[model samples]
Target: MNCEHAKGLLPALLDTALPADETREIETHVAACEHCTRELAALRKAAHLVKELPEIEPPPFFAKKIMAEVRAASVPKLSLLKRILFPLHIKLPLEALAAVLVAVIAIQIYRTVGPESLRPSDMDPPRAPEKAQSREVAAKKVEIEVGPYQSRTPVVSEAERPQARDEQMRAAVDKAGPRRAPVSKDSDKKGFAAPPPAKKAPPAPDELSKTSLVLEKKAKQSDVETPRASAGAGAAGFEGPRYKKPEEEKASKPRELHSDEIGFTESPPPAPARTVEAERPAPRKLEAAPAEPAPPPPAGLARETGADMALDRPWLDESKKAGAEEKAEAEERPRAKSAFSAPAASAPPQVVTVRVDERPRAGEKLLELLPSVGARLTRKQVRFDRDVYFVEIASKNLVALVGKLKELGTVGKASVDTAGDETVIELRVEILGRPQ
Candidate 1:
């Protein structure tokens, strides 16, 4: 074997893909040649030396530091509890409720046991503190105490009559000096100031009458408690619950002047008697006569007024004219047709035709085969020119590849041409690729 052949086979010989004959020949050449023998020996020794090279060991702390840093920088493992519950909507309300419950309880406890602070000394004794003062104040308040109204009838002995007289009342009335007008008490037939009429008397108590007399007894009960009350601001209770604010007395007032929305007061004169322009009597419009199949008016006048009768009647007139014309033409057509007769009875019909030539085409089925052969030969892009297709490939022997493609079915004949600068093949194809 030649040195070049032997050298080329050396790698394959080592890989064992070479045929036995080639391997044997290469082995014989290497054995006979001393230079090749020495080269092979050197290659073996180099490979052995590479295999024997020592493994490197980094510094002891290198791995430890790297591992520590990696661990420190690594993402933490998510808590399974959080992972399981985070995205669920159900847990949100539960967690919110729990948090709210805790907050409410905490607030309640705080309010229940919060510090007891003293209020300002100037404020009324805290919380109805002065029971005595409060009772006094309350007692002074004008309260209409309702007792269990016990109903009863009064009895009087008829003999006690003439005691009721204006003179008897005048003495009592005058005695009670120019004080407040006192409602007089009632008197019986015997009068004698009728025991200051029982709690309540029917038949209208004789108050301020000739038969009645008002008592002069003077009693100072609660100063605030008075039978007659004045509609003044002083009556509203003071020192009520902290939440009850003092009453606000807004005196109702009557507005006297008109004001604009902007708060500017303008004494505007009454809108000048609106001489409402007597609505110009909506210009009377001339009414047209109603239509009841009336004969159409002259075209000129109707057209001037754009009357539908004149415009519409023409269509009917045109239809009637067309009918008359059609009838006259129809009556004349048969006579006209009868005057013309065919000269012959039978004859072959003449025909005119032009011929066209359509070239046979290679269908998609055959075009697909071109790609397979072209791909096997490492072909890339292919271009078409009329009946010829040019294929660009990476390898030679493209002719042989084209021959293999011819085995596939085709609608037309083809020939491969491989004369080109680069590895290119030309094919006489009738079909080219189509847009998908």
Candidate 2:
């Protein structure tokens, strides 16, 4: 074979992988060429040196350790079924028992004491007093008998009097006119029985307008007048500082607190008709409304709100300003270029022509390659397109012939045809090398 063929064979022979034909070629070349003979000798010597180099020594104890371990006692063997069931036999029953115990305890606890335990007790028995209650009942009876036009306060012994008198006094203060409010002395009794004439509530200045509007409507109705005789009896019953009058204004005292520390005796509830109805109805809406409003927040809530506002204001204001600035920028700023830039309009139909001097088409030069490589030409296929041709050629010589074809410009791509024992290859050609 040739020098290139010989070089290829030499590498294979050195690797000991050369086939028979290639091996014979290598041997023949080595025999005739002194240069090849020297190269082979040097290659052999290098390989020998590599093989002769001192072998790596393993650690001294490595072999002993490996042998000792391999000869060591074997593991105790169990049947495959026992191995598979071993873990489950120990673990599964314990898991099941734990699960069952947990379920039972959970159920028992749930059935015994439940989530409702977390709720607070809100129930309270009626807290009205029994002593003044009889007196109040007496007052209501007299009020109905007297047509409710006359006051029905009755004289009672000092021992029979309850701090309810203070409640009565406070009721009076609540009904007190623009005049100065009576200073109440339920100071001794924390709760007072509301006596409308005696009931006193602090009139908040702001609610005064609403109070006035309601007060005006109530004013049109008839008020009970004190009878001359009962008034004298009531006046005489008021003995010195002990019978002191109730303040006409309500204080911020908690109902429960007053009862606890102050022994506050709140007024007996107004008798349903004459003595009680008016006082009970008048302040309930206003006082209750304010108290309810405060229920919306805990005492610390206002400070918390103020703190939250303080914390948020800077960021909120900055963001708002930033948004405004961004808006301003958007309005006054230049429009951005489109991100895609319209894909360069498909590169503007750019046509670059390459100089291809010798290109084979459906022409006479193609006839030069026809016979040696074995080609069957179809005259009709070559007739129409100046750049196309058809031929039937064997695939064996296809690569070599195609290599020569490239030197003549390009042979676009070949179309292979199988007919009987022959294969056909068709190709398109371009005559003009540059864009016109």
The candidate scoring highest on lDDT is 2
Per-residue C-alpha lDDT of model 2 across residues 1-436, encoded as one tens digit per residue: 6555665556566676867876887889888877777777777788778889999889999989987776653322345557667887767888999999999998776543332111111111111222223333323322222222221111111111222232222223334212212212221132232222232222311233433433432331112222221322132222221122111112223211111211111223222111110111111111111223242122112212332223223323443455544343221111110111111112111111112443344244555766667754422121111333334355455565565565555655443222222222222222333222
Poorest lDDT segment (10 consecutive residues) of candidate 1: 278-287
After best superposition, candidate 2 residue 35: deviation in angstroms?
Answer: 1.8
Per-residue accuracy of model 1 over 189-307 as CA lDDT, tens digit each = 22222222222222222333322211111111121125313312111111111001101111111000000100110111111111100000000000011121221121112222322
TM-score of each: 0.19, 0.25
Global lDDT of each candidate: 0.28, 0.33
Tell me the spans in candidate 1 whose CA falls farther than 4 Å from its real position.
11-22, 61-66, 76-436
Best by TM-score: 2
- Cα displacement (angstroms), candidate 1, residue 403, comes to 96
